[model samples]
Target: MSEPILSARAVRKTYQSGDRRIEVLSGVDLAVERSETVSIRGESGSGKSTLLNLLAGLDKPDAGEVIWGGGLGLDVRSTFLGMVFQSFYLIPELNALQNVLVARRIVGGIGSAERARAKDLLARVGLAERSHHLPSQLSGGERQRVAVARALMNQPQLVLADEPTGNLDERTGDSVIELLLGLCADTGTALVLVTHNAAHAAKTSRQLFLHNGVLQSAPKPIQP
Candidate 1:
């Protein structure tokens, strides 16, 4: 088998609430292969987001490590990782086109070709006509589509999405989900999705339940 694009080894995390210590993740491990999709579902406060953060290098594991592309020293923000959150993190001041360009800028290779790619991504997400509009001018689903475009701007090998559909209504959420899955498939980007939606989780290649600060295989979801 090909090497996994990302892996976590015996990861653990903890937090302090007032005077009490809370263990959020305990010896968690996971691997994501190229173009593979994995979904994690858990109750609120089950450390789902924390795990994603650790995997993305947004946070450090208290006891273990996360490795990307077979190493531990990679910069998550560079070309290796992309993140989408429940709240659209688009800049209010930047238009959709410019917002997508931000990722390319982050990796420090801005030019006409990259600009063209950004515009193409906007069109892929059905935002070509809205590319000049600000986040406030777009609908919630439109904004999230822009977020998806931004996430792909750097051609990341892995995309870590945290409740990407949490804020939208069911119909809109389904569309966003379809768009997300379709893009990831087309780009061969490994996806690590953290969501509470069982139906969404079921669509992935693997479904995991996070409980007691650990991850376990979830039952196979019934197919229609």
Candidate 2:
């Protein structure tokens, strides 16, 4: 079998609050293969977001390691792991294409080829016509699409998304989810998504549940 694209082994995270220590995750283990989508389901305060942060290297774990295949290692924040958030964290001043271009620039110097690639990615996300529109001028779904395009600017090996559809209507959320999965499928990028919606969990190849700072496989065929 092919090696996992990303793997987290016995990961743990803890934070201190007023002289009290809170454990957000404990001994969590997960593996995601290339071209596969993995859903993480949990209630509020269940540490799903914390786990995602660790996997993406936005935050460090208290213990354990995250290994990346393809010689990427655990330095995801500095590596080619892309991330999208529910808040549509786009730059309000920059247009859609510019937002994506900015991400490419940060990964390295953006050349003409990189700019063209960003434009193409925006088009792929169905934002070609709105390339010049700023986040304030776009709808919620459009802004999220721009964020998705921006995440792909580096052609990342892994995409980490936190509640990516939580801010949209059902129809819009479904469309956005489809777009994300489609793009990841086409690019062979591994996806680790966090959501509370059971229906959304069913879309992924595997589903894991987070509870009380622990992670386990979700029940098969998560009920909608």
Candidate 1 local Cα displacement, residue 189, angstroms? 0.8
Q: How many backbone clashes does every candidate have? A: 0, 0
Q: For each candidate, give its TM-score against the true structure.
A: 0.96, 0.94
lDDT per residue (tens digit) for residues 87-170 in model 1: 999999999999999888877968999999999999999999999999999999999999999999999989999999999999
Per-residue accuracy of model 2 over 25-60 as CA lDDT, tens digit each: 988989888888999999899899999988887788
What's the distance in Å from true for residue 211, model 2? 1.4
Point out where model 1 deviates above 4 Å. Answer: 221-224
Residue 74's lDDT within candidate 2 is: 53
Global lDDT of each model?
0.92, 0.88
List residue ranges in candidate 2 displaced over 4 A: 70-79, 221-224
- Residue 190 of model 2, lDDT score: 82
Per lDDT, the best of the predicted structures is: 1
